[model samples]
Target: MGKLLLFLSLLPVSGLAGEPVALSEKTYDPSLGVLIIQVNWGRTWKCGQFEHAQLQALTFTQLPLEGANSVVLELQTHSQIAAENTFLPYAYVVQPGEYQLTDFDVAVAKSKKEVIHLKGAKEDMAKAPQSAGTFTIQPGEIVYVGHFGLDCTEEPFLWRFYIEGRSEFESYIAGFRQKFPFVKEVPVQFKLFSTQRFGNPYALENPTVH
Candidate 1:
């Protein structure tokens, strides 16, 4: 467990496969399954394109498992986005059961600067990363549902997070595994409606991959 957390703490393994793959046919543990909620930086939306700031911090709260409540999950990034794709592994190890993900927040900073939390009523036209959702994991099934894409280039800057479910999501998992070899190969069970937003603007669109 410590080793997995250590691997996730570091950001961007520094390379990507020439072509993305949809990892659909993978095996899972018969007694234990894994859940990965990855936050992508350095690839799309010119994240960290023109600034020294990188996505150094991220956190989520209120993840209720069998007997756990408000279990906080966090990840950190250290690599600067210099025209590269950095995948920060924000994975959580949980028992097979129903879980609710909510109260998500993110922070970006340069070296030695104070981190800022971005979960509030006001901050952008749409608070995509602060989205919430529910999911179920069987005893022998692994799932992938949470994903957030930070776009620093846009006006007012925002997190284009989504509930990915399709080939693209599978491709992301394949890319993630390639970038971080520490991640074990597990079957992906992505749900289309497993992700939704919290707070306002409440009418924002929840994106999904097909």
Candidate 2:
């Protein structure tokens, strides 16, 4: 009984106190990296509509590529929120290497209820112009790419999309990390391809001067 009491006393009285500190040390695979694709658009209609439009349809028609073949990575939409309150899509557990962002599409509806039906009827949803971009990943690093969707505030509402350059992409990742504390902040350099799908047009987009 004396030995039992000694062992018990050795245990830290505040056992749970260390949990948050332990969790602060985020764990990541040494051989893998993460790729986040952010799609920011007008959630609220410019019209007098109070409720924001629902993202009815969105998908990577062409996912990330390692070389000539598609990389085996699981893509998740709405992975997390950013400082600007934008939802982001990400590819998780990606092997450390260079990858090209191939073709992608997104569709938005006025209401969440309509989005459900629009998902099944993809043909019915308005799609953003497809774009191709690229970025690299080092072991235990996280890289980001940006695609913008602009929903104009007038009739015949159209959603226009284009890839953002490197500086802009870096700025976004920096802002995102400020709000999302869980993601380990790793400096990343990205390249977006403009002309030649995979081999030709890949480099980070420069932030526009506007």
Candidate 3:
């Protein structure tokens, strides 16, 4: 636990935002980078399971002498997207730098009336080791950051999660392109850790900042 405490100490006193905003602008400062990730949480969202899951936020902790300050990225759940799919891409503009796609928090429901907190240790939650989550981004680049999902099982409070390389889902790719045309033209990068998200499938107007 000493290591974990030390790591937490390194975090900035204040987070970037209380709630992360979705990508609305097609155009941003070319001087920065955009990091993207998607979560597939179909299993947990179906409602018959003992545990339910909700993503808190994603974190990018800057590497010393190698990158900018840490960034906390929030997301609009899949239910909010106009597209018809379980996948949700959380795109955020960030400062170009090296970072570790560290851990995140999940509010897990143990039962109809009981909820639990599933937090920390991405290495444990993801199939990939700690090293896979480390990556770098440069000015004007768009990074993929991998695609992952959560697998709900019969076990209570226990989830099967995975992390992997870029997403190859054609429909998702198309949605990404339509939403951010210029971003697609720029070569994309990947920095997401060995993956992993859930929900009603809340429908809302798309956050298209075109």
Better of 1 and 2 by lDDT: 1
Ranking by TM-score: 3, 1, 2
Displacement of residue 163 (Cα, Å) in model 3 is 10
Q: Tens-digit lDDT track for model 3 on 1-210?
A: 000001111111222442223444643557777666655433355433654565444454554423344454433234422323244446666767765555655556666688775565644424442443554668877665544444445432322232221232333445666666655566544333422222111111331122
Worst 10 residues of 1 by lDDT: 12-21
| Candidate 2 lDDT over residue span 158-198, tens digit each | 23233345454545555545544566345544533232221
Off by over 4 Å in 3: 1-27, 40-51, 65-68, 75-85, 121-132, 153-172, 190-210
In candidate 2, what residue range of length 10 has the lowest lDDT sum?
A: 1-10
Provide the overall lDDT of each model, using Cα atoms, as 2-decimal numbers: 0.42, 0.36, 0.45
lDDT string, candidate 1, 5-61, tens digits? 122343222112211122222322346445566555453332353323334444444
What lDDT is reached at residue 94 by model 2? 54
Those runs of model 1 whose alpha carbons end farther than 4 Å from true positions after fitting are: 1-29, 41-54, 61-71, 79-85, 89-92, 102-116, 120-131, 151-186, 198-210
TM-score of each: 0.47, 0.40, 0.55
RMSD (Å) of each candidate, 1 decimal: 10.6, 14.9, 12.0
Candidate 2, RMSD to the unseen true structure: 14.9
